[model samples]
Target: MFTGLIDKLKGKRTAAVKTPEIMGLRLGASFELDPLAIRLILDELTIESCSPTQIIRAAGLVELDGTWVYRFYTDDDAWLQVVAEGGQTDEHVVDVKLFHFYDTLDVAGQQAWDRLLQREIGAASYSLRERTYGRVWTSAGDYHNPVHMAEKTYDGDGEHSLTDQFTMLFERPLSDQRTESLFLSAEEKQEQAGYLSRSLVISTGITLTPSQLTIHG
Candidate 1:
């Protein structure tokens, strides 16, 4: 199945697959598109074939710099995008991003997502916002990783006190402009808020192993 997921979708999954009832961050566990193949990630996994079997047309979207981004069409609710550099839709991809935005999910579906990520990446390494911006990072422990972990709660509202958000940046890389913002722009720092990043980053790769973790539904 997908990476190791036995999950399946009912409709023809487009670049834009139907949004699940699950949250975006939680979907990370359920998603597994091969880094070498620049095509439709999985929408459904047949018993016989588990890899991506669909090809899609590029949307010709560009972002960050001149980097070309290709976004697929999912249902109106959930959105997944593939952004690559130099307009090269071929496999020479340096940056890859998959996003899951779904309708509020049932508990079973929701837990499915959480358990998968908790098993893969240790946990969301950091958090932010007066009202919980909930950024999940794909990092083993570092927050700069492309993924931002979602928060359990969103009461980031400075009800206790007005607060400022601190963001860490990692110079320049694949998709976004992270590091330049804070280093070139920070004019002040707070003295009291407690912020110690697990500063942890975890990385795991897939292979042709019999012990891969599989999620079945």
Candidate 2:
């Protein structure tokens, strides 16, 4: 899939597979393309590939086991297609499967399979934090570090003063929707951001919504 410059430069391709249960399919060698490119391609595909009878509802990338995958859904939020990287051959055919139910496994077997999948997929969540401290004043006008305040003060007035308190909130909401890959890498993030920005500019005459954002991603 990555062999050709035109194909690689084009980045990814998504198609709707005609099947009973599955409504869509996406194909790509990497989620390494600019996000704007992904969004633009998706927008085009949404209109071009969908039929009057079947509406393209949602589409985006997914990451499983460190590899990026592509996904598409229908208006009913039904699984349409799930394609993984490294599965395409020289013919450019994707190793995608129409949505199908796996054979029901017994409780013990299901548990084992779940554990194995988790090991490969890593944790389902991530968090990060940082801390720093320096000379600062309290609401009562007392300095946090007297020695530092003294060293930096002149005529009992400090070079730096903390007159107000500030706080920041962080939260990660649980998503009923699925996540594509681990957050796109730093480079990929920049690319995707740029792409979306450009798309918004071009689509200025159109009303954008959360659904548009989903398609953009």
Candidate 3:
């Protein structure tokens, strides 16, 4: 089910992208690649696609835990991750950590990637926000954030069976986080601003250093 979705992309893939590594699964997952590359495995596989937040919630609810997991993408400053593996009919995506590893728990350099992300996907979609939590998520274990689904399509006659598309989930960005101070010294303000950062759900392969996201234009 290669949609050329990631292939035709120059960074902004989806969820601000990820918000994915879009790897090509092969025998490497079967024989050569480290077994640690695998993330979650589906048995009944009831869903076509889903988000990382959903998976994290399910794990907490069912008490399923793992140290061998990782995030592939996000839209808003790498804060929210969107995962939906429904299109792959060949069913070969295993140990996807090849794209990355579990690093969303840290929020160091969380800022401004979604801007680049939203640009690639034109404005031709619909969005739904979380009923509560006036704020959005910036990582894997935060509140469920809003989503902008792309590629709207219809079924049959195109009037009665219309359904919103979810192939790509684009998360909406919230206002920036900055220090509010008019009475503080310039140095103090600058230092405070340094603490301000977007939510981060991914990081370098295995380092405290935040993953440096590549931005275009």
> Which candidate has the top score in TM-score?
1
lDDT of 3 by residue, 38-133 (tens): 123221121222232211111100001222122322221121121224342224223221122223222233234343233321233322222111
How does candidate 3 score on lDDT? 0.22
What TM-scores do the predictions have? 0.24, 0.21, 0.16
TM-score of 2: 0.21
Candidate 1 has a TM-score of: 0.24
Worst 10 residues of 3 by lDDT: 180-189
Clashes of each: 26, 7, 20
Compare candidates 1 and 3 on TM-score and give the better one.
1
For lDDT, candidate 2 versus 3, the one ahead is: 2
Residues 52-171, candidate 2, lDDT per residue (tens digit)?
Answer: 122433444443353343434344322233333454222332333222111222223444434423331122222322211222123343312111100110111111211111111112
lDDT of each: 0.27, 0.25, 0.22
Question: Which of the two, 1 or 2, has more TM-score?
Answer: 1
For candidate 1, give the lDDT of residue 11.
42
* Local distance difference test, candidate 1: 0.27
Model 3 root-mean-square deviation: 21.3
Judge candidate 1 at residue 42 and give its lDDT: 27
Query: Between candidates 2 and 3, which one is better according to TM-score?
Result: 2
